[model samples]
Target: MFKPLWVRSLFIAFTALFLAAPLMAEDVNLSERAPSFWKAEGQDNTVWLFGSVHVLTEDHYPLADKVEEAFEQSAYLVVETDVVNVDPQAQQQLMINAGMLRDGQTLEDVLGEARWERARSLAADNGYDLEQMAMLRPWLIALVLSVTELERMGYTAAHGVETYFLERAEREQKSIVELETLQFQISLFSDMDRDTEVAFLMQTLEEIQDLEAQMEMLVAAWESGELDKLEETMLADFADYPEVYERVVTRRNHNWMNDLTRFLDEGQQDYFVAVGALHMVGEEGVINLLREAGYRVERQ
Candidate 1:
């Protein structure tokens, strides 16, 4: 099953949209480009929404003053999930339990001979051991292949937007919160039907060959807050794959709305909410959802 560059791009896009960032750049000039940050006013407090890159180069750092100020003022930092606090061992165990194939099945049995061979070749080219990787399901394989390629490109989660704030939140002892758990996030991929998972893996393999260039386009759109370019590059083509978009972006955004809006209504404290940049744009995005719900949301 073939997919477009944008569809394949989602495999990489999810890196930023979900797990983490983009193609590691040698230099990222943030002086002129507006940060993907916005503000929503509440009756007593405010909510700051910063579109985050899950993994990024060290050069992306020294966040914009607007973003920094929001964090400084807010009492709580909210992310999709608090991955930093998850125990490493437990994290590994969860992946194992969730991704492992059934006892009687092998990856070849699932992906079929030709497709399995293609996956094996892709894995080796990406420096993953096919034999060990063969034990997992398609979604898990796709996840591993994508992340490993990003790491090879020098983009890493340690330098991600959430990781940066998460560490500081721990040091300064600021309150940290999660919109979802790691388990729930993982389940999003794991629960896909078998055919969809196969297509996902296959397109992902095709996508990563030119992953760096594709991500550069995505990161540029994200960095400059060019909503049109972002929508075109990241979302427009999803008209053909609405189910994936609904599953990966829409439903999750709606689910997060309850928690996101509560910060405003509770009047307890301001929140600096950061999720993947994709969640902040489009008609169904969290920002618009906030606007539709009658809050004053402005780009910062």
Candidate 2:
């Protein structure tokens, strides 16, 4: 039914860590450690920006009451993607397409022996075989690897903020707009080099041991809404993998910023914009960039 039990478990653990720490100092600034919700009140429009952790557990969510209220008050819900109403078959197809590698390539050829062996060990620990994941794209592999590790630790997408909002939007008939398409998101991964992909996978495997502790600190900071700490920790970790960081984080932030401006200008409706928390921090973050663009962004 699920990808695998271990994969599911890893997502659960990962989500739990994110929810447990609402705020922490190790990876974020104390002031920014608060919730990533902001409101830009204007004479004609009110925009609420929410920093969101994509995946979580049911027990950790609904967010705060204020968050729910914000949603209720908003005229529209804007998400990174409109996964809420995506066709089941289309979504599955996207995942399957994202997982496939180019015809000639194999995981072993790309990862080499030591790394491949480590991947095999990781697979075994998670109750699967490395070969099973061989044809998966590097980016998809990275996502799967991350989700699997978190699942082993106990995080689940079932409880993720995005998933929750998606459910709510469906029930309430709220209008939902996608900031980007799944195809665009998937293309980011397809653009990466084979070596970079292999390196990312290997690095992720190596980090598995410290994943819990690191995630704990990150989660605490995130829950507390400490943007600075979260930014610092995430950036430091990102520096270790520039390829993945550039593709997944940096580029996407830029793209989202462009969409935000267009959305604000055209929609003319109150919106609750929920995106990954990480995208809302750092110099290149949406919040900071929005401020630079002359929009007054205040924490709510």
Candidate 3:
């Protein structure tokens, strides 16, 4: 599931948002090249769509001038889910309600003996007590493992792309819009098929062994603004899992198309739409979907 550097990069960052605190941004020279930026030109107002890495290391800032310029010009900041504004207690409750198994079901029951032992060993190696996570669903456990592994490598949600933009937006008093509720995002994990969830957890555990290399490749691709490379690295790993890919990536993109179209149709206020970088790539992504609707979506 996390084969691509960016998808894995953001997924872990997304999980860490609940536990991490905001931090001040570092001062640095503007990057020569940053992640991809697109413009969805409308009859009147325009929407600037930027691909966001949910979690990042300190080195990811300061963003390229184009990103800052887009933020400066737009009236609103729209994201998949506005983590920065949500209450910590409410967010935690949302996760618990969606990610915990009911009745007598334990994580060990979901993972089985052999896989459960492997999970325990992995957690132990990383200095975590797996027993504390026995009540969490496999999807939640996968997130725990990912967040722990990413933290060990120095990535933090405090430095994520959305957090960066969100902080600046707050200082500037920009209006924020959420495409989906926090509960909606949590349900993506809660609704997973049991077998698929276990396989997803196992795959994440396998990928942890190569976390360093994966991070390197992903960070480089993101900073270089290589959209093709990003799509390949992110989507190739999930080709075999059509159901997961469809649900996690394709379906969400489909669902967002209408809301995105309304932004264009309204043409009343300009928008700076920042979402996970994964949503901007591939054929079924918002970029092509908008193009298919007869709007010019250009890389800016």
Candidate 4:
């Protein structure tokens, strides 16, 4: 269902945004603007890149005037994936196919004794029951717990950047495009090797405890465009897990580069691209990737 697949997917996107360090002039006056948005100039067409916070408080809008203007000027809206308007049956099938454990294997078997105990303790402390949650892969359980914690805090994907723009796009009858499919996004977690998945799950469990504070920090960083803390969070969080960082952040940017550049180079109309902010961060981020490919990607 959209409930399960996009709940996890939305959490993943928000988590990824925590890793983004925007490329903008340092110490810009927040009163003037924020730097989480950009514009790429190609020979013919233009692409407006807005780094999205996947979850936000309802008062977080109306967005900045520049972002609104960019959307108004564009002919198409592009997002990482369409979590809305999905087939519930197909999404549930994908979840079942990718998230379930095989015969004779258990969560404890995969996580080993100490990690399993840590997982169980954390889940129980957070009001989850491991026995009832058994048989799913560790990564899926991690995401499930993360989504639950977020919901408990009253955040919903209905207030997310993608959803906001998506609803407006629909109302305006503007075309919408997806950079990836729901299945591919799921495989980013599900296709990881066992150890990688366990490590990811463990880190997620440890981090969710301070989620509220971390979330406020995320919003503060977004508004101020000061990224020292987020850069630190990004490195400390993913530097040890190069594979996880690659799959979740860098590699996906590279994959999206193909679609992004095509839109820039050959599209019949201009586009507005809204992606997780983290995919636009770091040296290997999509904004830099576009610049390296010879487009002049400027902060908006």
Segments in model 3 whose C-alpha atoms lie over 4 Å from true places: 1-29
Sorting all predicted structures by lDDT, with the top scorer first, yields 1, 3, 4, 2
Candidate 1 vs 2: which has more lDDT: 1
Instruction: Please give the CA lDDT of all the candidate structures.
Output: 0.75, 0.64, 0.75, 0.72
Model 2 lDDT tens row, 1-300: 011212211221111112233423365443333467887654467778887766654435446667778899887888777666779899779878766867788877777787788888976775667787787765567667677766665555666667788778888888888887777765655666776656556666656566667666656666766667776766665565665555666677788777676656565677888877777777887888878887778887
lDDT of 3 at 24: 22
Clash number by candidate, in order: 5, 44, 0, 0
Displacement of the residue 298 alpha carbon in candidate 3, Å: 1.0
The candidate 2 region of ten consecutive residues with least summed lDDT is: 1-10
TM-score between candidate 1 and the true structure: 0.90
**202-225: candidate 3 lDDT, tens digit per residue:** 776676677766666766676677
Model 4: per-residue Cα lDDT over 1-300, one tens digit each: 011222222333243321112323565543355647888986688899987778766655677778888898888999988767689899889988899999878998888899889889987787788877679898788777766776677566777788899999999989999988888877777887887777667767777777666666656666555545545554455656666666677778898888888898898778999887666777888888898888998886
Candidate 4 deviation (Cα RMSD): 5.3
TM-score per model over all chains: 0.90, 0.82, 0.90, 0.87
Candidate no. 3 TM-score? 0.90
